[model samples]
Target: MKKESKTDWPRINAMRDEDIDLSESPELNETFFKDAVVWPAQKKQITLRLDPDVLDFFKSQGKGYQTAINKVLRRYVEAQKHH
Candidate 1:
């Protein structure tokens, strides 16, 4: 069963930029972007069957469920390589 969110999203969306506090937030400068590394991971498409409950568990995580599933499988593959 899908759970309902108790968050007041509409009210939060209506808030102005100035109304939000950012005093503790760090400012990202050119140095930060310069040090950033990008990984262009290639993906291949394939059909895979999963149990209803297993599929539902991933789907319940909201958006990017397929990507989340891929991450889990990727970790499993990496762990097996170490054995």
Candidate 2:
């Protein structure tokens, strides 16, 4: 028996042949580097307690669970910064 894997997102592959309109789109060349790269994270790691139910909820999303959690945390941080 073997586990199943998900198919890759076609848009990403299709991006290779995409006829991007650089003049119309502001974000096309927004990044500093032209090459594909992972953006840097502004926050540092710290251990914190979370309810079992909350952890289970994000884990069920299958992938990018940590990214979801970080997004929530980042929203909170951004709100606090403006106060």
Candidate 3:
């Protein structure tokens, strides 16, 4: 038997709120968001040098390449903190 994927967005959106099922969903409360950290939207400007290949790779991904690079660097910093 083939397994069904859960990408049925149209059908899901058409559902009435009362007809929707939420038995498997976890309850969210104030405690769930108490410790959440909010990041500042402001960005700092700095000059940095990168190898030609590295810069080219991100540039090929089209717009928002700089943001993508920042995200990768952020993940690296977060991982290093756990050590």
Candidate 4:
């Protein structure tokens, strides 16, 4: 069974822009935008096949299994470069 949300969505949706308080928030200035640098991750998506047992072992460790696999692969590649 799905759990019910406790939030009052109707009341939140009915609120006007002026009704929200922004006193505690910081104001963004031109200097902030000018100094900002954009660094994008050049990741490519691909489908890979793994043996069931190997896949299960990574999944058993819980979240970030793909990242863990990537780290292992990266270390292997680095070792190969040194050889």
Candidate 5:
């Protein structure tokens, strides 16, 4: 995990328009995104191998570690689709 910088927002906002890329960005259509209901997909059980530290980190957060892992994986899948 990486430490987040508190001042990153100002730096990002200061970036030049030409420095930004929107080629892969989705269109901001209100009608397309409005009233969206994201229901979780059915889950399947399986054994997965993970680094000891990675497993320990989520487990240390106490309860719902499995759900946290699922959320992380889902985000990764969604991100990959945009690329």
Candidate 6:
């Protein structure tokens, strides 16, 4: 799966000088990484392949066509996936 961690790089770099040794503390590591995990905003980009008809239909919707396509696809995935 393709995934990304959302990190505030400047903040992380700043912490490097803060006299706290992250490697020495599991809790610190968890907390640091946890803060960097993003609940993706609707702004994130996703990449997927689609049949020509499906792509053309969404593209015909004008602006924000990708969002519409994703909405349709997200519902489809949620409905079909098995736990």
Q: Judging by lDDT against the true structure, name the best candidate.
A: 1
Residue lDDT tens for model 1, 1-81: 389989899999999999999998767889877765455577889999999999999999999999999889877976898
Model 6, 55-82: lDDT tens digits are 8988998999987976786768767874
lDDT of 3: 0.87
Please give, for residues 1-83, the per-residue lDDT of candidate 4 as tens digits: 39998989999999999998899876678987775545448767899999999999999999999989877887797689879
Query: Of models 1 and 3, which has the larger lDDT?
Result: 1
TM-score of each: 0.51, 0.48, 0.55, 0.50, 0.54, 0.38
For model 5, the stretches where C-alpha displacement exceeds 4 angstroms are 1-40
Give per-residue lDDT, candidate 4, residue 65: 96
Query: Model 2 — TM-score against the truth?
Result: 0.48
If both were scored by lDDT, which would come out higher, candidate 2 or candidate 4? 4
**Clashing pairs in model 4, backbone N/Cα/C closer than 3 A:** none
lDDT order of candidates, best first?
1, 5, 3, 4, 2, 6
Q: 1-83, model 2: which lDDT tens digit per residue? A: 28665756575567654565567544655463554445566767789789999999999998999889988986798689878
Task: State residue 35's C-alpha deviation in candidate 3, in Å.
Answer: 8.8
Estimate every model's Cα lDDT from 0 to 1. Answer: 0.88, 0.75, 0.87, 0.85, 0.87, 0.74
User: RMSD in angstroms, candidate 4?
Assistant: 8.0
For model 4, the stretches where C-alpha displacement exceeds 4 angstroms are: 1-41
Q: Which runs of model 3 end up more than 4 angstroms from their true locations?
A: 1-37
Clashing pairs in 5: none
* Candidate 6 whole-model C-alpha lDDT, 0 to 1: 0.74
- Global CA lDDT of candidate 4, please? 0.85
lDDT of 5 by residue, 1-83 (tens): 29777778887999999989999987878865874537778788999999999999999999999999988998898789878
Residue 76, candidate 3: C-alpha displacement in angstroms? 0.3
Q: Candidate 1: misplaced stretches above 4 Å?
A: 1-41
